[model samples]
Target: MALSSLDEVRERIGKAARLAGRRPDAVTLIAVSKTQPAPRILGLVSAGQRVFGENRVQEAEEKWPAIRERHPDIGLHLVGRLQSNKAEEAVRLFDAIHSVDRESLVTALARAMAKSGRRPDCFLQVNVGDEPQKGGCAVPDLPRLLEQARAADLPVAGLMCLPPADTEPAPFFALLAKLARRHDVAGLSMGMSADYESAVMIGATHVRVGTALFGQRGTEDG
Candidate 1:
């Protein structure tokens, strides 16, 4: 099957889980809705997706409020590089922030979280590939940043990493798993539409899948 709808994606989720020796519900599929129309998001929502992700804070600001008015209880995850200037908006919109990797952003998010009296969940984005273009904290520097976040009461529950595009993502995922364990954190958000099987094999607890579910997002969006 070509997998046109969210239901088909869920079935694929099941198959992927079984292949990984895990329960079908173990992996969370972040229906990436960045650049996708709101009606399409509603369609996926109707198709039984409670979790969705968006890349840019600005785009999310435009789309999420309208959608939330229609579905107030859905979980929204910010899966993009967030700037300190937009921290306030991100705090108000997302249930979780998965791309918090910098000291300034952590401080900003702390302020936002405190202001709302809400402890929003977060992930420490680790730059496992050491790519210059990426926005993640360097892996070697993650421990300090993670400690800083914890000290600031950022409610960090896990680590996230985007592996190099050219390499198999499994090794990087495995490394993040080890780093999380070393840091005593429980969540590892790695993997994507392409290498989720590799992610599962390496103990990824959450995978950010976009194209495999909702199809490829706009180049500028993801």
Candidate 2:
């Protein structure tokens, strides 16, 4: 793993937060550890990165169970599409889930949380760009989704999104912020390595950065 890259990204996050008159410490940096091996993840943990994001429940199940045993303070977030059947496992495994995008998921998660007595923070992903291929709830449906999640007793943390790739992301970020405020939610988990600074500047409470911290995907796995 690139150690200096972590420092550099933190520095960038701080700069962006300051530029936006927001506190640097307020923005959580979730190291996207999907496809990365344990040694690389430990290297980042050694450097004091306590929060990580994973793309799949099965992959994270393989990688994190042992790691969490050693570093219980580490937080794991699910940042990809979640199947309704895996809701219980996801509740048991992740500390926060950034892909609670549908009604079935909300109900499943609520049932799982009730059964397990654990509530991982939930983020309702919004398909801000309305990309049919994306995994988030459609923009017009966000309010209803949020209401369902809350009514189901899920811990609604905030909103998350992946902007239309290759387009400028600030406007989408702003729209998410507006929705969060309108709905009285607080967290905004947007941005990635390419555009995190803009995200922090636009009031992102969390940024999922992978490439800048871990280097290209699967390159350092060996």
Candidate 3:
């Protein structure tokens, strides 16, 4: 079931990318593995899924170190609200971070990177829908945030966004793509289980998916 699900998702991504005139390889599917057990994660690993995303640094620490020791090719990503204090641990654990939204985190990550010499790929999360409760940089503050991140010598790989729930997501995905191009950033990490196909049509470089790959939460726990 896991292998078939992965294939289906990959095929959908390929079709979407081709429809947009982009190569299928251009879009990376990041399995959202937070709350999933090691056996389930290993199941995907056995099926050739190498990249995974976690919502918290500590959760990732508890599981990934052991998993990675066995499958060293696996890439872990932090796709959650990152606290400033966890910067050092995040830097050491994640290969990529998708929720860099503030100046303080930028500063902390900068210091941690310099101290550890591990430069993880970073995506500046933008609140494309302007949701007050979301965790992303405001559209208006993006330029300044990008400046600060660049000045800090952070990798600054791209932009990420979680559009308002239950609304059309294409517009938000397009907006993020425009912002990335305007900022001269190449990667766009926008998309999830539901709207990833739409996001691919708008040029998303990374799509984070959970439910489509794994079964519903708590349904198949180890």
Which of the numbered candidates is closest to the native, going by highest lDDT?
3
Report, for every candidate in turn, its global Cα lDDT versus the true structure.
Answer: 0.83, 0.92, 0.93
User: Over the full model, what C-alpha lDDT does candidate 3 score relative to the true structure?
Assistant: 0.93
lDDT (C-alpha) at residue 53 in model 3:
93
**For every candidate, C-alpha RMSD to the true structure in Å:** 1.9, 2.7, 2.6
On TM-score, who's better, 1 or 3?
3
How accurate locally is residue 126 in candidate 2, as Cα lDDT from 0 to 100? 96
How far out, in Å, is residue 82 in model 1? 0.7
- Checking candidate 3 for backbone clashes, the offending pairs are none
TM-score each candidate: 0.93, 0.96, 0.96
Residue pairs in collision within model 2: none
TM-score of 1: 0.93
- Candidate 1 yields a Cα-based lDDT of 0.83
- How does residue 141 of candidate 1 score in lDDT? 95
